[model samples]
Target: MNYSKIMFMIMIMLTTLMTISSTNWIGMWIGMEMNLMSFIPFINKNKNLKSSRAMMMYFLAQSIGSIIFLFAILMNSFIMTPIMMNEFIKTAMVIGMAIKLGMAPFHSWMPEMMSNINWNEMMVLMTWQKVAPLYTLSNLMNNWSMYILIILSTIVGAIGGLNQTSMRKIMAYSSINHMGWITAMMITQTKWFMYLLIYSITVAMLCYMMNMHNTYFINQVSTMNESMTEKLTYSILMLSIGGMPPFLGFLPKWMAIQSMINTEMMILMTIMIMMSLLTLFYYMRMISSLMLMYSSMNKWMKYKSPNTMMVSLMLTINMSMPIYSIMSFF
Candidate 1:
């Protein structure tokens, strides 16, 4: 099942991981190029005209970002290389990474492409593919810029998701919101690995749940048509996604708040909390849709669960593990 494309993606990640750890912007740019080139064929593996068009659009967008990133690197190059970070160069790099991460104002391609792509492909596209580029962004910033991005991302991500009816678009905006939490935690990258870890575990768990339910379309899981089990799953996932108490998602936001308070970013902390309220609407909409008791037909319907109890048990543990990690700190 397209093993070669999968292998290519792995190589791209490996290459990017190596280059981003290096000292020069040129090396990082090369790594990003490697990643961008490798993903083109992967995105088009199904050979649909739509997939091809999405790939083309992704390529063009990444190309522009790369060129701008490379130009910024070269523009600031000097005969005597400065040991310190350059503001302009860092800002350019920030924009480049934002484009890659599907942050708002630069995130047009992500939702459209995610909607059309297959779930397994979308799984990789949404998750594993983000690691290397984001790690690079973390490397480029100190605690301060990270804090700024955290706030900016929360603002744009929440507001963007507020108006979306499309399921993939909602996830795309959710990705941005997730990025905000991770970026905020980046201020103490070493101390806050817990935040990132919890966030990743939660995201992967949600993806697994989505896959199991065959819920590619949000409408598919609505309370009106889906069985009671699926509806139960929808409620749990919405709580987890919205970082409501007792769910796995709350852990990272908890850590991020602590980190922000320690940094004396009180205003930023307040803004993040406010934005979380905005973000809650879309997730709660999904929940309300799932738990609606009225049925179009008066008969109870049953369908086989797509998972073994073991899988459900494991995901529950994944969510629980992060909670324990958070508790230990307190």
Candidate 2:
């Protein structure tokens, strides 16, 4: 909310746009570097030990990725003789983007960093910071290795959060899982942007509610002195985020599934769907704790209702299926 943070946020957005719109690799690299610089301030905005550590880890990971990205670009521009070398450079570029985006195998830092930050910063990290690298990776996703990464990311993401107590870490792993679906979208070259848009909205909603409540862990949810309606609202949002049917979050997955089926990627599609169920299982576990498990409540504690804006947004997202079905009828 401060002027300096606002300025940096604007810079981040502008640089992401620059990277996505750039015609060449060097320009994209510069844009990514600028975005990184703009975001660093947010990482340490709290000036605590955890934030400091997160900032350091984030900086190191991004710096290494940027260096490899730049080196690969230079090699591609200067040494274009052999086909094998060209393929190697391409793979290197993909690896660089993967590290930057926190794809599987390069993803260990994401959950650790996210768990250390506040929800607001984690929202940006989970959503906006991903744009440039994901765009770049989509361009380099023609190889078989990228498919392997898709599988690894989905599997790792689905399983990694099973034991997590921290809500932020759970969201981090969920983002990684969604990244697999998004990356897979690149293969079909279909509605990846739609998927990202719906994902951003869902994540922003969840983070906003968590930050408002100052909720950080799974245990906190069950202990909150909330009304049944409020708990039900939260449960619906969680299910939506897990891509349950009749919610806005499920729309993009439906599109992606249709595209995969059309392309005859049955095996990959089946794996992704199964892994997605694992994600839903954890979400349901959290919801059960939220709605079913009750702690002794203080009689004087007041239950707060969600704001009108949040309520309206929730209604809109939940109604998406019927809206889409009606539209399809026309």
Best by TM-score: 2
Q: Lowest-lDDT window of 10 residues in candidate 1?
A: 297-306
Candidate 1 versus truth, CA RMSD in Å, comes to: 3.5
Q: List the residue pairs that clash in candidate 2.
A: none
| Best candidate, lDDT | 2
Residue pairs of candidate 1 with colliding backbone atoms: 223-289
lDDT of each: 0.71, 0.85
Write the residue-wise lDDT of candidate 1 on 1-330 in tens digits: 868976987877787686658676777778878888888878888878878887887888788778777776777877224346577777877777778777656777777877776666666666767776677777665734556667778888889888777666788788888788777677654444565566566666667767666776566666245554445555776777788766777877877888888888788789888999888888888667667656554333364554546345644654583557667879
Pick out the ten consecutive residues of candidate 2 with the lowest summed lDDT.
297-306
Q: TM-score of the candidate numbered 2?
A: 0.93
Q: Which ranges in model 2 have alpha carbons more than 4 Å from their true place?
A: 79-85, 294-306
Q: Model 1 — TM-score against the truth?
A: 0.85
Candidate RMSDs in Å, in order, are: 3.5, 3.1
